[model samples]
Target: MKDILMEIIESKRITLREQKKAVPAQLLENGASEERKMFSMRRALANSSTGIIAEFKRKSPSKGWINRDASPEEVTAAYQANGASALSILTDTPYFGGDLKDLRIARPEVNIPILRKDFIIDEYQLYQAKIIGADAVLLIAAALEKDECLQLAEKAHELGLEVLLEIHSEKELEYVDSAIDMVGVNNRNLGTFVTDVENSFRLASMLPKDMLLVSESGISSPETVKNLRQAGFRGFLIGENFMKTSNPGEALGSFIKQLN
Candidate 1:
């Protein structure tokens, strides 16, 4: 592999600089200070019968465009109506074919917790998430230094946004702590973009017992979800499976029916 994860991060740094200069942190801060509607993804997953965190993503680094013309608002509303516990909206444009506007567009359509899924390397993104109506943000352990991850999580908290720390292997388990709202096991390797759902099962017993656990990527079967639930996972972040279909919401509804 070509270390694609670092490639994305490097591109992200450039994009961040341009974004900060164009929008200014103060503007984002002021907008974020204004109270916005909020929902608790952690609570939603904990109380739900089917813990499906449906994602609104247009593309991926490995698979390229999944659903190029999907509308954020329409798909998200359908996910909620179908039985999604929460929503994960990709806000990174270069690799994910998504932008902050997706969250802004999807926010008013659903009431569930909206997690801004991206390669977060700065607090400025946290302010942007809040201002645009995100309830939570994903912090990939592979994408940050130990201290950098903790600092970003802390800043997310200060802005009243929950942090879902994503880890790929057991070493990243050390990233888990009191500040994290949820711990997610990403089945996909960021470096190679390969997926293995077993990663979640492999790490299930090691994750913090009290913390909510989420299984991200490579999950398409209801049986796998059932097995993961038994393994201690409460939230399932599934994107490509649903997004690849023409009727994503309907696909999600069918998946939930199978799950039950």
Candidate 2:
């Protein structure tokens, strides 16, 4: 049987195709060029004391409906006010209960970099991200071959957007390239949906020393962030812990205070 990750990617391809038909790539390019400006997630994380990339997500496939009615403006503004180094907004509507509109809504509310959290497979999506006002885009190594990953990363850079390459295992490290801005190790296994924080710890040493490292997914506590920082992780992508709460910004504020 096909795993959930594969299923989602397949479905995403169909969705992308349909979307491309509705809004041609040329149109996307024109709109992208008219965008205000792009922020650097890498620079923000490097300069921050906490290096927290607070995410805005409504739901996930594994847990289902984490915060169904969460507002982007409210939650993201809170994240910024609470010392978030950056912002990540999920734009996959089908599985993640998010839309591109979420990022658009949250963009004006925060000053830090915003990462467009999606399974980016096509170049069109990169243009869409630029047009939608995303600072960076996620490229999952598990979803694309090495060449495809490189092509996307290069294109993202060409469009003046940063690339956050996410890898779950050691083999995926080959996806790393010069065009990629940051390397993110996702603790959750996309195939099985099993989460293990140790994955980040285990893979930390294998990454390039010159590359900025980020630990993504399953990071909940300040203690875990401290440990990961000791293990050489410079950035942390946290979502569920704050998003599941009644006030994500206040929760993030409290979490940052604990970190300090």
Candidate 3:
């Protein structure tokens, strides 16, 4: 059987081929040059009370069709106004029901850093992220080799974009390079699609002490957030918890309040 992560990455390659033809690499480079001033997600998470990177995801392969009609502008504005330390906007269309338009729409509405949540396989996507007004990009360890991850991280930093390296297990830790600004432990197993928050706790002690730690997925409660924080996690990326609700921003606000 084929793995879901590999499947998404292969699909991403096909999509990127078409996108590059529609908008050449040079054009993307030009657009990146004109992007607004960059924000530091690392800095925001370090100083934030909630340390929440509120995510705006329409859907996922595991959970389908989550708020397909949610407006990025409305949701992101609410997230920022409510106390989101940063923003995460899914830009993958095939499996995640997101597009670059979502990030573009959300960019002007919020002042916080916005992470381009996608399966980054090549350097072209890094330029695409910069051109699309993303302050950061997610590089999944399971999707790329160690050298590829390091190269992508270097390229992202050169373009003034931060790299949030996502890892699922301890072996993936080798993918962490000096260029990575944040290390996120995704609790959901990409192969089985099962999530356990304990994955964060299990891996917390193994992560580099100097690197900022972020706990992603399977985090739904303020108590969970508080516990993760106590375990040395500075960032929490929550999506389905808030997006599943009728009012995601308000949901996020309530969650943050509970944390305080």
Candidate 4:
């Protein structure tokens, strides 16, 4: 079977090289350093009745072009007004059909915490996230080594961005650390592109009980969110479920209604 994760990372490196030339690291850092207050995704989930981190995505490697014409500003604002605890913006262009402009545009549209969801493997991306006004970043355990993850997480902290460490299996659990503001269990296997919401249930017990647990991907119904909440999950990172619909915010609003 082809490894989709490896392919994305390779493409990401090539994209980064071009981006780095366009915007030097020091210039990116300077922009990120400008005074900006960050909303806490962890706290938002903790305090919300529906811990829905609504995502705005155009496409995916598993299911291409989910919503090619969705406007980041319109969808994200609707998400905030309709009852989302936070927002997640996909920033990977090659596979996800998104770029930094998605987050940059969506950032000012919503007051809720916005998580920059991408195949992040470099520290330079952290600055990119911060400069674009993202409050959090997704760090996939399968995409990075322990040392690399730690270094990137530390850099994220220095830039005042929270880190959501994503793990797919028991082995990847080792990447959990103090730097992580939230621990997310990815339901889809990056290597195979297969998804099962039960993956969250299977790993829920083994994850740190005190950590803010988040269930990511393959979550279509509110019933699953309720079950995961009972299993100690505080947040649910849902994208395709809502993005695939004609109106993502309305889809998210209807999903939240079921949760209540």
Candidate 5:
């Protein structure tokens, strides 16, 4: 698993470098003016009881390919309609089989906040996030140092984009700060590639009170969400659970009905 993770990291670096030189400067231009309106991820979570941050992903490393055929527009619309507080769109291409185009296409279709769920290493991606009209960006604590997380969170904030700092364990909890708008407990162990909703349960009480909170990965049912919410998780990030089905919209509709 360590070897596989290293390969993923290397492949991501190669993809980033190749993409940087091929794309036009104007296409990646930072639209700082559009940064005026700030949609609060914390506020969204606070207002919702269910607090589901439904995700639209094409594929993943652990699960391989899932639903590459679903359009971003269709998925985002259904997620919003099914009581999702926000939308998480995977934009990494190599392993996830996702791209910025997927995120951009889903932007105008939904009214709720959109989270660009990608492996962000450089500041350039934050600007790219704004260019593609992303309302928030996911920053993994395991992938970055404390200082790096703070700097990236600040950059994303400057662009009116919320930063959801993802932590996989108690050790990573030290990186949390005011710069981040939310803190997410990724239930899946990226190192071992194992998932369990109980990971969120173990860490829920340790999270800070002020920031929005989310539980990511391994969330497949309303019962699991209920348990997590009871444990004080204000947000839930669900990915392949819905997209794995043939009809994601109906899949979401049924799950949401059960949730209610």
Candidate 6:
């Protein structure tokens, strides 16, 4: 599994670099002419009571298929309308079956900050994220080295994009730095595809109190959000729970209504 994950990471990096180089300089120049866009998930959460960062993921390596037919606009708008503070758009292709176009499409339709939820192993992907209208990008600590995490975080900051550094366990806390805007404790174990909300609780005490904390994966109920919030989490990233339903937004609306 380690070898497979590494292969997928490497392949993603190569594909992103090539895409970056292929963009014409003229379009790049025009896009660069405008001031860089800044998306502050921290601010979004600060103003919302629920602090739900609703996600728009089509598939996953572990889950195989979540919702391949759902439109990003319909789902994201529902999340926003239902009091979601922000949106997480999975941009990883292949296993995730997501694309940068999803981010581009969702950002313009929704006002919330859009997270480019992808396996980012190289710095070029940060620029790619910005060009495609992403408000922030995910940096999984389990997949990146300590210096790599810090370096990528700095690059994302310079690009005016927020960095959400994800940790699967307490061991990944060593990668945290000032450059990271938020720290998400992923409850899902990528190696075995097992999920437990307690994984987030177990690592909450290990994170520095100065950092904004988020819990990702395995949150399906309002009770789950209440419990995680009590454990010091400021945000919750939920995807499959809503995506698996026939109407993700309506389901999210119902979920938030229950939360309130």
lDDT of 3 at 73: 95
Q: For candidate 5, what is the lDDT?
A: 0.83
Best by lDDT: 1
Candidate 2 per-residue lDDT, tens place, 1-260, comes to 44999999998999999999999999998888774777899998888889999999999999999999999998999999988999999999999999999998988888889999999999999999998789999999999999999999998988899999999998998888788899999999999899999999999999998889999999988999999999989899999999999999999999999999
Clashes of each: 0, 0, 0, 0, 0, 0
Candidate lDDT (C-alpha), each? 0.94, 0.93, 0.92, 0.92, 0.83, 0.84
**lDDT of candidate 4?**
0.92
lDDT of 3 by residue, 1-260 (tens): 55788788788899989998998988878777774789999999999888999999999998899999999999999999988999999999999999999998889888899999998998889888987789999999998889889989999998999999999998998887688899999999887788999999999999989899999999988999999999999999999999999999999999988999
Candidate 4 per-residue C-alpha lDDT over 1-260 given as tens digits, one digit per residue, 9 for 90 to 100: 99999999999999999999998999987888898878999999999888999999899887888999999999999999889999999998889999899999988788899999999988899999998999999999999999999999999999999999999999998899888899999999999999999999999999878899999998988999999999999999998899888898899889998899
Q: Lowest summed-lDDT stretch of 10 residues in model 2?
A: 29-38
lDDT of 3: 0.92
Q: Is candidate 3 or candidate 5 better by lDDT?
A: 3
Superior by lDDT: candidate 2 or candidate 3: 2
RMSD of each: 0.7, 0.9, 1.0, 0.8, 1.8, 2.0
Q: Which pairs of residues collide in candidate 4?
A: none
True lDDT of residue 158, candidate 1: 89
- By TM-score, is 2 or 6 better? 2
**Which pairs of residues have clashing backbones in candidate 2?**
none
Q: Model 2, which residues run further than 4 Å from truth?
A: none
